[model samples]
Target: MNRLAYQYVVLRCVPRVDREEFLNVGVVVYCQAADYLQVAWQVADDRLRALHPALDVDQVRDALGFIEGVCAGDGRGGAAAGHPVGQRFGFLKAPKSTVIQPGPVHGGVTTDPAAQLQHLLGCLVG
Candidate 1:
């Protein structure tokens, strides 16, 4: 299989932006040639609580769910709905000042974007 270029961003949870602290919570991977865009996430509740006991884990999960919705082009994507894979990815990776945000964009080559997503999620977020 021919390798294809892919772009990705690590999803981060900034419990306190003022302190410039964040927790890696997920990953978004986009492989245009493969028509693939997806996310793999795992919220470490204990770790997040250690960071900010007042932080709402449910809310964080909800934000992550919205990302999943955007990837699927479903109702959860809200204004991002109806967009193609690349556009959806752009929306997800856009800079934001919120509890859930994306890290810097990165690139790599992959034969399976799905597997790559998992690996990155583990390496970067897990």
Candidate 2:
């Protein structure tokens, strides 16, 4: 199989942006040729709580769910579904000031985006 170019971003949880502290919470990946755009996330509740004792897991969970919806183009995706794949990816990769933010965009080549996504999740967020 030909190697396909892919891009990914590590999703971070910044409970306090002023302190510039964060925890890796998830990964979003996109491969246009494979038409695969998805997110793999694992919220380490204990780790998160350690970072910010006052952090609410429920709110963080809701934010992760919204990202999943956007990746899947579900109704909860809001206006993301109306855009093309690249646009959707651009939207997700853009920086944000909220609790959830995307890290810098990174690139690689892969034969299987699904497997690559898992690898990234493990290496970057897990």
Candidate 3:
């Protein structure tokens, strides 16, 4: 199978930004050449509570849900729904100061981005 260039970012939940602590909640992969974009997420609630017992995991899940919507073109709340795959990925990967944030941008080559997304989520967030 021919490989295509891809870029990805680790989705993080920073309960507290000042202390710089975060938990990996998901992975977003974008393969421009393949016109593919998707996200795989596993919310470690126990780990989230470990960071801060008062942390609101539902809020995190809600935020992540929007990302899932963006990837699927579900048009949830009309956020980045009609944009190109690359633009949608750009919107998802943009940095934010809120509870859910994206880590540094990273790149690789993959023949199967969807499979690679699951693999990365398992490795990074599990």
Candidate closest to the true structure, highest TM-score: 1
Q: Candidate 1: worst 10 consecutive residues by lDDT?
A: 72-81
**Residue 45 in candidate 3 has what lDDT?**
90
Cα RMSD, each candidate: 0.8, 0.9, 1.1
On residues 1-126, what C-alpha lDDT tens digit does candidate 2 reach at each position?
899999999999999899889999999999999888999999999998888999998899899898888889887788886677788899999989999999999999999999999999998887
lDDT for position 121 in model 3: 92
Runs with alpha carbons beyond 4 Å of true place in candidate 1:
none
Alpha-carbon error at 52 in model 1, in Å?
0.8
Report model 3's TM-score to 2 decimal places: 0.95
Q: In model 3, state the lDDT of residue 70.
A: 92
lDDT of 2: 0.91
The TM-scores, one per candidate, come to 0.97, 0.96, 0.95
Cα displacement (angstroms), candidate 3, residue 111, comes to: 1.1
What local lDDT does model 2 show for residue 63? Answer: 91
Per-residue error (Å), model 3, residue 80: 1.7
The residue-by-residue lDDT of candidate 3 on 1-126, one tens digit each, is 999999999999999999899999999999998889999898989999999899989998998888889998886726587788888988988989999999999999989988899899999998
